[model samples]
Target: MGGRHVLRARRLMEGALDGPDGLDEEELVRAARAVVAELGSPGRLSALVAELAAGVGDPSGCARLSYRHVLGFDKLLLVSVGTRHMLRAHVWHPGSHRAGREDIHNHRSALASFVVRGTLGMELYETAGDGPLAAARYRESLSAEVSDWLLEPAGRARLRLTQTAEYTAGSGYALPSYALHRAWCASPGAAVTLFLETGAGRRRYTDVFTGDGRDGRAQAYAKEPLEVAEYLAELRALAELIGGSEELARS
Candidate 1:
């Protein structure tokens, strides 16, 4: 069942990419939501992820899928690179322990996210300025770029509440490029999400910021893309930890 869901997602993404011109944010969101609805919950999605990872095996293998951990959660890259779009599975643990209640940030490319498991509370914000959200930027030795932001003591940048939503298993939402918002997991539980990014790019970059200058938290952070082999290992480890092996075989 779980493997079927992964296949279903792959088919949906392929179809969208193969469409006459291409899928926009709305179309992509609808497609991803369909997959989430089919998978039913985050646990189901995790099983599929584990199954895929276990199949990939070690570094000498030839699995095209890759992975990375960003902002705390383990993310599995579902498709190959140089494609028109990208699909990622975000696996979050008990709390926002890696980055507590994330500071305000936004993406350059449009994305549609589905909550496969647990719950996530999203807070959307808006500012008077027409530029992107406030953030610090840095370059990494691995040739990847990183960005960070503070949320407390908002300082001169006043953020206006624009929208708020809580997404549980089977629920999904879409965000346009430059949409300013942050998310936190509901207490006492883990969360899993699937994100479909259209027109993705490394050069596009991200920004993070805090509310005021008094907050001592570091405003800069590093980010690097995960290699395919390492990503497979992470998935296999997660599969073992989550007891998805039995289901993975059947998948």
Candidate 2:
């Protein structure tokens, strides 16, 4: 049953990506929105988790890719189609220490996210000629050998907040790879989101901005991948959270 579910999910995603219009930005965003709506549905996601936890099918080695992101969230990779596309479940725990919550950054690939279990707040920013908000910019790259993040100081940047919005469960949004933004859990409890990224025209590095005055030196952060046992445990917990939540029932 789990194997069948996994196949169905993969096919659904592939169909979206291989649509008639190809991978144009508009088409990609449309596909992402559709796929996220379908897969992020409580029933579908819960079933997928149950099957993966039961060890029914190989998740394309994504089980080992799960990790705690530096921005204070658990990124559990659910599916990977090479480097072209990735589907992940992001769990943001309440009261978790957010080391880089104030750091504004962008992704290397176009992405979208669906709030599955709680409210999410997002703020968008753009570089300005002069602004009260000043930041130290960094060019962030990943080491292929060790998967560590290398942050090289770029220069100073002034930015202006352009937009702010809040999304509740059953809602979502998409963004281009160059969109500068920061997000956090706005609800009082744990929040879960389904995130998808497309690797078409992925950039080699991403721009990161930090308000902290650490503009003089470079920094490196280690990304430790989760062990298989730990990964399975997380999947099981997610299944329970989605399948047994009263709030989800009410929603």
- Let me know the TM-score candidate 2 reaches against the reference structure: 0.91
Candidate 2's residue-wise lDDT over 19-41, tens digit each? 66569876687778788889999
Q: List the RMSD of every prediction in angstroms.
A: 5.9, 3.4
Candidate 2: segments with Cα more than 4 A from true spot = 99-102, 244-251
lDDT of each: 0.58, 0.82
What's the CA error at residue 93 for candidate 1, in Å? 2.1
Which residue pairs does candidate 2 place in steric collision?
A: none
Q: How far is 249's C-alpha from truth in model 2 (Å)?
A: 18
Poorest lDDT segment (10 consecutive residues) of candidate 1: 135-144
What is candidate 1's lDDT per residue for 128-177, written digit by digit as tens? 56435453322111222432222222234545668888997668887776
In candidate 1, which residue ranges exceed 4 Å CA deviation? 1-8, 24-29, 35-47, 57-70, 95-97, 129-156, 200-203, 212-220, 224-230, 237-243, 249-251
What TM-score, computed on C-alpha atoms, does each candidate reach? Answer: 0.68, 0.91
Error of 2 at 155 (Å): 0.4
